[model samples]
Target: MAGGDPHALLAAAADQMGKPPEGTPRRPRVGVDLGTASCVLVVLDSSDEGDCPVWVESAGSGALQDGVVVDFARAVATVRALRDRAVDALGTELSTAATAYPPCIPVADARACTYVCETAGFEDVTLVDEVTAAQRTLEITDGVVVDVGGGSTGVGVFRDGRLERLDDRPGGGHHLDLVLAGALGVETGEAERFKRERPTDALPILTPGLHRIAESIRAMTRGTDADLPLHLAGGALMIPRAGDVLAQYLQRTVVTHPHALLITPLGIARSAP
Candidate 1:
């Protein structure tokens, strides 16, 4: 397997997201991510550069918790809205999509993610694990891809571009919000805002939570190659210096990307057939 530069792919994805070209030779493929905090829709051209995102949009929804689709109807509605927005922006109908679930969830729960996309009107839906979806975007031949989302941290160990091991644990941005909320005497919503808008002030208060997440990674990747680098995806660790904090705690190289939150969603699109 050939290793491609994940940083370059992420940069291109960032640049192309939400800005589809006027006309292209191939139709666009779609990826839908039903995250605990939000639902994202990503579209990409089926051309050679399909790795780059063509259109992207997100909407906050409480249909999921810890990557499990709890409110089936709400999840379907959220995805429908996102798909409609992408179609309107690109002036193309999106009939097929790929979606993902965290690796820790039961197989039945994972199927809920696919159902949501299909219920939202997608004629064809592909299902993949969240960690594998992220790998599709990063193309990391040998490394650890960690997707720290609102409710869980999913780790995927890869060698020669094949997934060697995968695991996920509950503990992510939402847990950090709880820690910050307790420390600052604020609501969880306010804590989330503070963490994002004033990370410098919030990082100190949230370090312990970050460490917990790091420990989860350490536990999940226990038997994998110790020297492999760690690549970060998902939004929880999008805070400035979060990667540095993780590296310092785990004493391993950590690779972060611009628009880290979009990695899995874009990768899900890449999985579309």
Candidate 2:
């Protein structure tokens, strides 16, 4: 957990190994998240001035797909543009940074996220898994960290500060979009906006989809820590009733945070060395 070289970083702390953070004001560590639907960069300040996490910026483009860098040029340009914006806003050249990937993404894909940062001109790079990163920020010790983002859901089981198991698979908000698309006979994009704008009205319609995600979690962690608390992280579950749907299905306590979408990205920044 101390400042160490990149190789010294651990798998347990990978989620938050090198991303921006919350709570404590720490040195400005940058975190780049190459998400399926969006790419985000966050920087946290330790010694600067105010009590805050600095350098929170994100840009959405069809660059990365399902947590993989598809269009390399678009990914590079998106990250580069974000870096420039943060540099201009913070008045500091953010050369070194950390980034993260889905819990179950291959090591090569995880490294791809780190490369995205370095290609954008970061000198130092730390790699972390997305769910672990979320737990770092939430500090969930004996519980499940379920990250439902645009592309997938990552589940991490932790006890006594050690992650017991980690797994992830696709089927997130995007999947829900397909459901809505079929129901409403519209494009997935339109359903996404509909879910965001009218979630209260949309929850009933999306119940089956949300339950599907909940059931995925139930199947993955069926026997272990069945009673453990569930901390929700990511944007997909940000739907108003998603947590309750999970609670009803899982019969366990489910946690939701303000700005849940930033949970993993912010935790990734905290992973910085």
Candidate 3:
């Protein structure tokens, strides 16, 4: 497995969005991430070294909240839009895809994620846990994978390439936006834009929220091995020095990546068979 330069793979994936590299595998695997703040579609080359993303697209969506499908119709529409965008960019009909849900959600709720893909015109859909999908992208054999998305933080502990424990809680970028909105006296949408575009300016105001997330991580991993480094895989913690804040707060090793948000989505595509 390629271990020395994970960030390079992530950067390559980001750079290839909407324009896949030439000579990529003809039959690409697809992943649909129905997230709380956005829906992402990822296509990856189907080959021995297929982990790199070929095309990726995301659309802001309120269809899901905290990993649950809240607005079913909007969810389907968002996935359909993402699918169409990928098809247009890749020039191929994407009929099958893999999607994921937060760990420990009810089976029915998780099936709802698969149904979103099926409704969006996918003929074959595979459902995987979000954290495992992240591991597929990070390729971490023994560490904690913490997926901090827009609405939730999912923690998965793996030992020897096997998942040992999985848990999720209600807190993420959305909550941080709430904090920023309140602090800056701006609308939530404005807060989101500011959080992304002016993250450095917003980080000081958002530190408390980030610490809350760290506390959630500490709680989730209470009984797990403390020595395992925390590998972050989601957009919520992409701010500069956010990893340092987490490390300082938890006093544990924390690993982060560029385009952290795409980790789970790309892994979902890898989960496809």
Candidate 4:
């Protein structure tokens, strides 16, 4: 990775989401994210300039729950499909990759993420907590990184580029979808689609759920400096005006990046050894 604007890197990653970039990959760096509501795979090629994204792919499959691999076969199948597509596009076999688990999941659950990657065909896999992975991309030296994924929110406090405190609790996008579902008298899937497509309307309905997440952040970062800005990572809080809701509720600075969903997956690629 190079010392450039992290947002630029995210924009680059976003542009290559579905389309494979031109040129053959060299020294490929790979990252797999087994998210609660989706699975994402990123491949980067290292050069003197920096790590450039080559291929990025994702699958909308709910194979995990709360950082645990609930459906082992489905998880493996999803990762394998992603891996196979990357191989087809890049014309190279990705033998090793890094992956992440939500912070504070049971050790066995975390290991299950690695196993899923291995079973999906990676010969070697590295495991990282989701918050640390997000830091790899944001490169925040002295602040907080909060990863609001599908199943849970993980908070990490950093000082001088070193992590000081880390914690996680269950409550995230899925819960918000549930709230929307109940309010609209619709099914979970419709609620999710509405939340994505009609976020403006959804924000009002989702405020309380966002507040609950804010309260979780408040409790988790209790001893840390309250002045450090809260950086929002992951896809859950990518909804428009979501950061404003959090900032108003927490009375603290909340920084939300564009293409926020790519934060962790991109960081995970940067983390690959």
Best candidate according to TM-score = 4
Per-residue lDDT over 53-126 for candidate 3, one digit per residue giving the tens place of the 0 to 100 score: 67888888999988999999999999998888777666778898999999888999999999989999999999
Error of 4 at 181 (Å): 0.3
Which parts of model 1 have CA positions greater than 4 angstroms off?
1-5, 16-21
RMSD of 3: 2.0
Give candidate 4 misplaced runs (Cα > 4 Å).
Answer: 1-3
TM-score for candidate 4, please give it: 0.98
Relative to the true structure, candidate 1 reaches a TM of: 0.93
Candidate 2 or 4, higher TM-score?
Answer: 4
> lDDT by residue for model 4 over 1-273, one digit each (tens)?
433679888988999998956866889999999998899999989777888888889998799998899999999999999999899888888999999999998899999999999999999999999999999999999999999999999999999999999999999989999999999999999999998899899999999999999999999999777799999999999899999999999999999999999999999998897
For model 2, the stretches where C-alpha displacement exceeds 4 angstroms are: 1-26, 47-51
Cα lDDT of candidate 3 equals: 0.88
- Sorting all predicted structures by lDDT, with the top scorer first, yields 4, 3, 1, 2
Worst 10 residues of 1 by lDDT: 1-10
lDDT of each: 0.86, 0.77, 0.88, 0.93
TM-score of every model? Answer: 0.93, 0.87, 0.94, 0.98
Winner by TM-score between candidate 2 and candidate 1: 1
Q: Give the range where candidate 3 is weakest over 10 consecutive residues by summed lDDT.
A: 1-10
**Model 3 reaches what TM-score against the true structure?**
0.94
lDDT of 1 by residue, 191-260 (tens): 9999888999998988999999999999999977779999999999989999999999999999988889
When summed lDDT is taken over every stretch of 10 residues in candidate 2, the lowest stretch is 2-11
